[model samples]
Target: MPAGGLDIRTFDAVKALAFIGDLSMGQPTDHSLRTAWLAAQIAGAASFRADICDTVREASLLRWSGCTANAAEFTNTFGDDVEGRAAMLAERPDWAELLNAQGGPAQAIAPLAQIHCEVSGEVARILGLGSETEATLRHIFETWDGNGMPNQLNGKAVPAAVFVVALAGDLEIFSRVYGLEHALVLIAHRANFRYPATLTIPVNTHAAQWLDTLAQLAPAALDAALLTPQMQHSTSPDLIADVLDLKLPWMTGYSRAVATTAAACCARLVADPEASERVYRAGLIHGIGRAAVPNAIWDTPTRLSAAQWEKVRLVPYWTSRAGKQMGTLDQATELASYAYERLDGSGYFRAVGGPALGLEARILAASAAWVALRSKRPWRDALSDVAASELLRTEAEQGRFDSDVVEALLEGEPTATQSASPRNIRYAAETTRLSSREIDVLNLISHGASNKEAARALNLSPSTVRTHVERVFRKLECTTRAAATLKASAMGLLR
Candidate 1:
């Protein structure tokens, strides 16, 4: 995005992401946190360095982080991706037998593994976890044996942290899903294949004790343990937004679009920059709980059953749960979780309406509804601009959405071939982390201005122009001048 970025604590983001992975994989909440706790204990027994222990913990939490990337494929391979995976992780003998079958789960593993590896690796990088953690995640699917997806590195070629994380993850997952005795048997059988035997010994020795200690922790205590403070990542919170969109192909860029539009609407609604900023962020993560639902449910063409609709309603509840685990992010996440709530008290998760809703929350709810109306979904084609506008206003009239907030969303709809909407540009810059002055420079450059030309247009020195241009290129993930121009144009930053 050409807009500004939000700052989130590295652990906070990672913990939220871990929860997403757990949900997608059909595991209990804090499954990853439990795994991390187990892994850290194992690392301590082994006397690994604090940094290596940290790597082990992060890798364990993120092992399944790429589950969403391959969710659609998993749904196609297995009848239900979530339930199928939960069953696959059960401690039966040769439980992954179907995973190796020809044209069965085997055919999908290669591509799915690659997708998972790349996505999890990106998460590791965004959190600024060093090369060790990143490498561990990239090969998280690989086994101690030479058989793995994408890359087939075996033995020492795989990161040492991978084996540790694997052992710990299996301990948490298998024990809960298949009982301790069965889980231990499965872990023992995987000795050299799943992980080296030396690694298995300590786990076998302390497995029960570790699990008992984990079970002893109260819910609040467990949450406190997982939400430990850490250095904040200076990147955009949109990374999680992008990850959420990945679960459904049709949803690509939907979150960012909502974020930009909601911020723009907030600007129209009130003069509070802080309110605008919070609403924009809420827009970005409004669908954070979508990971818990299967793609089959999301991509269903037919009308959903009562059970399915019930699941849909709990989506916001899950998002709220995720927020509760993340320290200090309650406000924005709370606003986001209210995306489906209606002003008429007809929404899911919570039905309170009218006075209970604040201005920023109203903006997010209206923004999400408006954006979803404009975008295509499996059940329906996207509405035309005028049709969507009429429907939004009509819903407001019926008290489903706040009328004033709906008005703000409709204000200044941009023309297709003409200049981008100034309201949009302002929000984009703010949410994308660019300053007003930078937008001015980008505007000049987008219209084919040279460095000196941009400087002249903005009344700045050539050095300053060069600086802003470089920053824009970096922020937009473009290298060449043409690339920057094209990206800026897409972002509505160009004139």
Candidate 2:
């Protein structure tokens, strides 16, 4: 049984989030999944205990959790070259070579590596992982010869699972990119220097068979295979959200804050326990999709162009997709995807309206907006609570937000000072240049409503609705509903 009576589903959810880590590292979508599978197999072949196998698998999947915070540093030093960075990492360069190649001083590399390891370990702790797993993650890059970047533990001093994972990760990558024989060669070359001889010997002996097993493995099958009954103690959804929130400096603690505030609001509204929990979960991961966008875009201190804004709008869609990968989180994920939507059908990724938007989604949106207003952005300072409330009230009054949701958010807050009005706040004005009717038609189409259904809803003839949609496409400089929706969302035309 899981310690603390936590559900096994929590582990399943964490495994799913590993895919996001893979993306952040610029690897294939299933890189983490494959790494975990390979690591577990290597552990089993080496006769590791069942618990050790489980820890290895978990550690391998989450080894890159620290990359979210370190990506900007990598980009700044390496200039967005994924393959180059991969090559540099594969060579296992010393601190001097790494800094020299990246055009940074040798002194800067140690602190960066240390920060990455510490952050990864912290995330593991927050997720309730065992200390062994956390230690393995922290020492993931440490080598057998005591020449690793963060720590220089030699031979047996390195954590067993970390050694196993380091070899397994490279095995999967080389085997996939090169071939089975080449992967074995690479392992042999690095043996006794980067990986333990005991682990690498078994891998060398059964290279072909191991590669065969991994070749047949699929990303979707990973969770069922790795998350065995004994593999308990999964991280809660809220903690998973926090892991994603760490990706941006501005977004730190944003997800947890939203989840807590939203859950409290749900309780105040007298929602049932289930409803409150669902909203809380949704709030926790509402920004999970933000990972798909680059940190450069997120950290930019200027207005986003139309294309960049479209990328921002699709974050919620990506979050929903990530959530859907876990069987138990489907509902919460769906609500999270709607976090950027509005009551008046002004959301991006999907232009949903009042009828289609659920109460949980409304509360999630309200809470996210409230938290964001209070948090500092690259372009602006954090808003005072009263100022945020006033801005949210203005949004509600304009029909972009639900009045009830806004009221619930502001019930206990002090009134805004006179200086906090819209006239004083620097708002990103709507620039999509779409008329109200065009926006209406776009919203209907976004919800997958047929032209006839849209006509019925808007009380117009099918011909009129079609004309309006066509004009929306033309005006937005797009040819399809999907493109138009994205563009409009990026333009901030949607609520």
lDDT of 2 by residue, 1-495 (tens): 011222226565666567567667667766777788888888999999988898898888788776665655665665542333455545535534656765563455565566567666755655566788888878887888888767677867878998889988888778877777887888888988888677887777876786677678664676677775434544445446545655654464566567667776777785477778788778777877777677777877999999879989988877777764666777788888898999989887898888898888888888888888886788898888879888999999999888987888777543221111111011225343668888778756753467999899999999999899988877654444433433343343432
Q: Which tens-of-lDDT digit does each residue in 240-267 have in candidate 1?
A: 6656766765675577778778888888
Q: Pick the candidate with the highest lDDT.
A: 1
Q: Which pairs clash in the backbone of model 1? A: 3-428, 3-432, 3-433, 4-431, 4-432, 4-433, 5-433
Show where candidate 1 strays beyond 4 Å. 1-5, 91-106, 218-234, 414-495
User: What C-alpha lDDT values do all the predictions have?
Assistant: 0.74, 0.70
Tell me each candidate's TM-score. 0.81, 0.73
Worst 10 contiguous positions by lDDT, candidate 1: 415-424
